[model samples]
Target: MRLKILGFTTLMALLAACGGGNGGTNPPPASNTLSGTVRLGNKASSAQIASSGRLLTSDQEEFVPGEVIVRFKPSLSVQSVSSLSVGGVSLQRVRALGLESTGLYRASTDTAGTLRLVQGLRARGDVLWAQPNFIQRALKTPNDEFYPYQWHYPAINLPQAWDIEDGTSSPVTVAVVDTGVLVQHPDFAGKLLPGYDFITDPRQSNDGDGRDANADDPGDEPGGDSSYHGSHVAGTIAAATNNGTGTAGISWGAKIVPVRVLGVGGGTLADIADGMLWAAGVSVAGIPANPNPAQILNMSLGGKGRCADSPAYQDVINQLLAKGIIVVVAAGNSNEDAANFRPASCSGVITVGATEFQNARARYSNFGPRIDLMAPGGDVQADLNNDNFADGVLSEHRNDAKNDYDYVFYNGTSMAAPHVAGVIALMKSKKPALTGAEALDILRRTAHPLDGTACTGQGPDSHPGSDCGAGLIDAFAALQALDGGGGTNPNPDFTLSLSPNSLVIPPGSSANTTLTVTRSGGFSDSLSLSLKGAPNGVTGSLNPSGNSATLTLNVAASVKPGSYALTLEAAGGGKTKTASLSLAVGTSAAKPTLEGAYVIACFYLGNDCDQIKSRIIQVKGQTSGPYSFGDLAAGDYLLFGWKDLDGDKDVSAGDYLGAYVENGQIALVRPSKSGLNFALEEVQGTGMLLDQVQHALRSLRSR
Candidate 1:
């Protein structure tokens, strides 16, 4: 009566940095880069645009031609400084920065003598700031030996994803619902959470008992050959990364919850179904609730029957989907239509096929409308990396003796499924609340089309060539899709933030922060938390409490000393917001560095809340220098350093000792601000705004 579910190995860019030296038209030199704030006088009017190209906003709003943001001293009006001419230049205000109304303004001028105009403005008595906008680059290279050969990472544009995020800041839990993982594997150290064995039949449960809580693999050997399927799959999803050891995982910061649903002779559909539910933290009859439910579920095992014949499995998939857990499955390796497979053919699961390094579908991979996309599944016969090693997917496996951890090459729809699963984990790590439907959509929409144009055909169904799903899954493009093009959300519904926004730690030390996600504009759906951009030797952990999470950052003694940009994101209800922080390692009090800060203000525009700008500040102990906020949209605003002094992400009464604020709310006429140098003051009042900030800070402390 048990339907045995067998394992199926399913078959399957850096932009130039701004440089200087060439000419006004020549690209900036790759090495000579600049980083500073640009300030304007009046908000640039439409007619004030230069004679050449009119000002246009790039994604960062810093690429507008003939314009730089302007910040005026507190209590100063745009009109007061509007008449102060520099050379033949004139100034006009565009808008405020975020919600701030008075201090900051976007200014425009004729393109001629642009550099000279900036110099002239800086010297003026009325203008407080003028500088060129600086460009930042993403980390493109990892020093790992096999990284260059990981055509999979670059093929999917993971370097670009790395620029945006790495899994370190907000670690997401991914359930590897397969044979069982090698808990003692070095690559999986500290990465495995408590898991359960769902195999009810003692005969197939090779570990001696039936339906136990131990999820460690005892080595699945059907005919004297141990298949380290789970270990390999788990490694692909979260192998110890950037450790100068083995290959890196797509989402290296993710944690794996190994739920053993299959054993020696494989497992039945019933056990697999229960395992899937349990992986999502759903209650099973006799098993304890999974304390660390997975945000993403990877199922590389399936039956060879159409989903229509497996109502039970299909229902579990739907339930997992409804719970906001992304389900990723392998397209059956039978070289037939995936619609003939159990979980792969089921609705609501992302069915992935295998692709070789040549971008062609693997010879044994299934193909059909049901297949969602493809990923590097490796082809053992070829050495695509040309390193003299087989191109099979390299991951943590077992030695022939089955007693120690080793590396092995594997290829199948089973292998391809984990790549997609790992990518989904990466997406979830960046936007934790991404729904199953949304995850599926992003995979399909952002996949590199493998329409058989790039290489010769392969796969059993390959006639004209390879005919798989959309194409190779692109990690970078998929992550970009999560940002919804990195502009204003037309339906601004939720607001999320991380306290402390910046921190400093010594080598071998650790730090902590808090993240808060608040529903707004009528948002009610649940949201998920994720962290991105931690450097090597640093790991981020998230313990969630309702809409808030406490994030802890741990650094290894050997972590290289440098400043890292980190992001905290919350995604749900089909929308997302990201807050950033700066972590400087091996830094000292005497050598302080101004990481970054933010200010909130209200406006008269579309939403009552105008803009939230990242305010630039000096290092903690700096005595005096003008702080500037550029390209601010017009509105009334309040400023708070929001320094999580204790790293608790809260504004306690004692923590407010050095609170900084302007005399009162400033009304901005343009998108820049300067002067009105404010000093730290003791708590002056306890109003609704203060209460709100305190309330947000307390969310992280609540649990």
Candidate 2:
């Protein structure tokens, strides 16, 4: 029931699309009114009427309670629409729009029966739409001048999303678990919520106490300087935005619940784990329940370790997931795969990597399968945007010598995680019921894959490289997906290639390949190149970091003969694209290949269709009758072959797409199912997207 601008063009589009023609002479189709929410033609004017004399304070109200705006059928007069009565209650027309003759009116009812009457009006044949006069919030953009330099917000498309919802109405709390926050910073002024200090060791808490409720920063610097790390992170997520102050925050309307977990010398695992649960609303023995539990938790800290090794931390994450609270953690800043980090590697959390201003993975940002996505953590070296400012993220900081608050730019995965945390705030503000898994999926599905390139190999000796996550977090795109839309930047609309698609070499020998990128679609941006995947005992390197480069693959003398597949990604101008490379160490003749036009894999039994994973192959254009899919693990699986017609990469009803059915299931204990074959058949969309998919897999038993 958000009060939006509802443009004239949009109204016409809705009328035309919903079968309402002749200037609302006909009622909108039932399908259009299924949601039973109020619809308004002029949202801005309506908001002005509602907020004319309302009190403006920190505890500001978003919408008028116990009231709804109703638009009667065009045939009905304004007087007639307002004269309506329900259940012995008379509706009052407090305001009207569209010349006094039209039927739009803002009506009032007692709070006791507001919900019931609103629903009843929506069902009336005389009513066109009945919507609650939802409290409208001002666009949540901050007026801090330095906000222009904070390029991270635009990189993730935050501004576009702010127009839809500023996250003010929903009381979504984001718990920042870090060193501590400078509560007096101007940017964080009335936004701080009551938080707790979890540092049990008095020496580390630096407050001369242990486990207290005061969550203030005591400055974690060794030389008595303020670390400001926690404060910086907090500002990124919920600084006092749009107040014409310092810097704008992402979710300016959401509350900041600061939980001090890390301290002067770094925090212990036990303290961190306990703080996480407490922030999530779980009561720790002897401690009071957190009255304001967070819907989103931001942990911008991590250490080296496979998450599976920590049973205590993993259990807490599961608990938070069940509570519908999303946990976002930073990938370690060690420039290694995030899979080796503790909570970043933990399941049920979204792990974020860092990206430079140029949209390439930040040199220090960790990556790998565990990494969910990337955000601007900042890179000071290259001025891709030529803004004359370092690309590092900017936030509130305490200048020790001045003994006052200031701003500073810092880089790390720690900085990257909060960007995601803030975006989650926006998502939860729009849809409060989103579960942790749903948040991750929405992020992944809407993410702009590394400008169009996949993260690959390291760069040079002086300039280290990074393998990024899915891509940059496009906040606007995510909201669009939540609203049933898709990606907007179709850039990287170019081609990627290797001079030699395949290479052959022997032990102690080397091979050279040329990586090239061909730009198209008016794309003239310089591209950054990266490589990934060299077989065991073989290493690959790209000479330079641009559109075209030479790749050198050095094979160790101890390496065995085999074939390997490698990936190359190119990023630039807010776009990323990728191409695959193949290398042969000695011989690939011994490798087993699957025979199929298209391949489908169903794993993790229960005979679950939900777990069904499929791949479409090109057979009609291939000169060979049979194709081989390499190296699948041993398991009981169901395989299918299909001719993809719609090119959506999935089987759907609208297209002539068909899949193989008979004798598709196989037991690949070893080389047993090598020669299996099947044909394709037409199927409906329901078969591809229905309950069968969800029924295929069951949850893994936690220890």
Candidate 3:
């Protein structure tokens, strides 16, 4: 909501490790060597590689009996070592290698010809990288937990769907691209494989070591305390199952790979981009590959921009998508059009919007044609228990200033994005064969479209049927769709055009428009058309005959002139098509425009004329003014007026400060402006009333 200016220097330092190291005055490539005793599966004799290059056996651990890892010196290649005497017998030829988990002679090589060989072993079946597990500990729910009622459910229903398919057997890896995960949490213990930290503040690490993950520059302070944005997200994805503790994850059997990108304020685009590659198991020249790779990448943070089409960001995203990784991003929180933001706006990534538990769009959730699906982002302020005020939602938060094992409530699209990510993991677990795009298509096709204001129609209206991109997402429907048929067309062909593409009509005015629908196939009788994004004070209706439909609307005089989109849907005969119409409307002729210097005096009046009391005055307005009245506490208000001697309406430049009027009455007779002028105080009793009235007038002028 608020933009914090960040120093570029800090960003550059965080991004330094992202770039592959190049040859120059920098130190030569380090040797890949390990000097330690190797023992067999049983505690038999131990084999050691001494500094003299002789392999000797002792009672400690044995290397020759089983697979053992051996590091070769510089300039030596695995291909040259065709035959080597292990236990006095020449073994098979050794070749350059990839990776082995943790046995003897597991071979992996660096670009400098240094080889790591696992002695007496060969590559076999695929290695399953486990998700980060969470350690569940019970604490009295904190009083500060926001919106506790919404989080009342012990374990959501979707994870149960995963259990039906035995999904936890081979846990899927979900990368939490936020603050680092609490590896020590009871729910996350042993589940967290090795991961990297790109914060560059030199204070954050996978382990609590002073050294960075890459042994490069010191990283930033892992700002874990701000919010458990990552931990909560991880918990939702894979917290560990049947531990008999708190809530269960969508894929309780899966693991989490904590990729710390965001920090104190937030992370940069570069850090996020690099984190994506690392999580997907993409190899970089200098840094060691992720000890654990992810099948699904969850990004719950986003900024405002059309990032989907940007080449700089898309290139990296495309690389991951190509690797069969489902990238889920949060639609922003601005409650504006989501087509204007990055990551979410990108085509390949699954962009998720938020809705309340009541199945309506969250008041603060952003929407647009770009939104692929919606999930429950608790409306903390909603009167879930019939209360008048919003209590907060219960979630994981930064426990303390140090950002450790603390958990609290946090409500945002950040909280909602993980729900969908975890769902995707369950989907993937059920149907491991589904590709990223196929899984996304299934989720969208199966989601139960939310009805009412939550849906953004191509036209203006807050009602259910007038919104956009279907309705609220239905997890049950999504799983069903996955089971029925996995994939569908990512891009479909359909065209919708509207007349009077843009217009500005006064309040209480009406306009007529037509939506033309064209499809690749012939016309059909059964088609459904809906409108979204209607400006305030405007309403629309559609009259469908055949292939064409007429949309009629009247704009209220109070309607603000702005751009709006009209989404038209044509579904029939087992297939559906979507299109949008853009519209604009002007402000009302008699709309109140506040001007000049003023002070507000708020009041509450009872039904009877006899009861009136002063109330708090809060301001909300555009940036052109000094304050915003929108943030004001509730109550009616009056404003005090000041004269504009120069007639400028504003007290600025060379204007003279005129006398303040307590009421409509003032020494100046008949002020020239409409809704201007004050009556003289002939009765003392009316002075208080005049003061309130004058305050209201001043408040209007200030706006």
Q: How accurate locally, in lDDT, is each candidate?
A: 0.58, 0.60, 0.47
Candidate 3: TM-score? 0.48
Better of 1 and 3 by lDDT: 1
Per-residue lDDT tens digits of candidate 2, residues 1-703? 1111123343234323322111112222332111011111111111122221111111221223455556666677666545667544567764343222222233454432454455445546675455443221110111111798899999889999898777786857999888778988889888998898877668877888888888898876546665667888899999999998788899978898888877766675556656778888887754677888998999887665566534446766887888878899898777777787768888888999888776777777777757778887876555667777667788888888778888877777788899999998988888888877777767766677763233532232232222454567888888887787774434325567775555555678777767877543235677777777766788877886565789888888888865567888888888788777666565323321222223333332322322222111223322123433333333334333333333343333222212222212122111223344433332221232112221221111010
Clashes of each: 57, 19, 108
Mind giving the per-residue lDDT tens digits that candidate 3 earns over 141-170?
123442233342222345335435535755
lDDT of 2 at 670: 19
On TM-score, the candidate that comes out on top is 2
The global Cα lDDT (0 to 1) of model 3 is 0.47
Q: For candidate 2, what's the RMSD? A: 25.0
Off by more than 4 A, model 2: 1-145, 381-383, 451-467, 487-703
Error of 3 at 670 (Å): 57
List RMSD in Å for every model shown: 28.0, 25.0, 27.1
Q: Once superposed on the true structure, which residue ranges of model 3 sit more than 4 Å away at CA?
A: 1-143, 146-163, 203-211, 214-225, 383-394, 401-406, 456-468, 485-703
Candidate 1: RMSD over Cα atoms? 28.0
| TM-score of every candidate | 0.48, 0.50, 0.48
Tens-digit lDDT track for model 1 on 1-703?
0111111111000001111112112222233121122111221111111111111111221222444444455567554544335554465553232111122223464332343344445445554454332111110000111565566667667778877778876899999988888888888888899999877667677777888889988866645457768888888888888899777788878999999977866775556666788899887655788999898888887755556533456556777877888888888666777776667788888888888878788777777767778887767777766887776777777775555567777777787888888888777778877777777767666666665443233643443323466667878878888888532222225567666555556677776767877543224677777778877788889999887888888888888766678888877778777988677666333332222222222222211222222122222233222333333444333333332223333332212212222222222222333332333221222232344333322222211
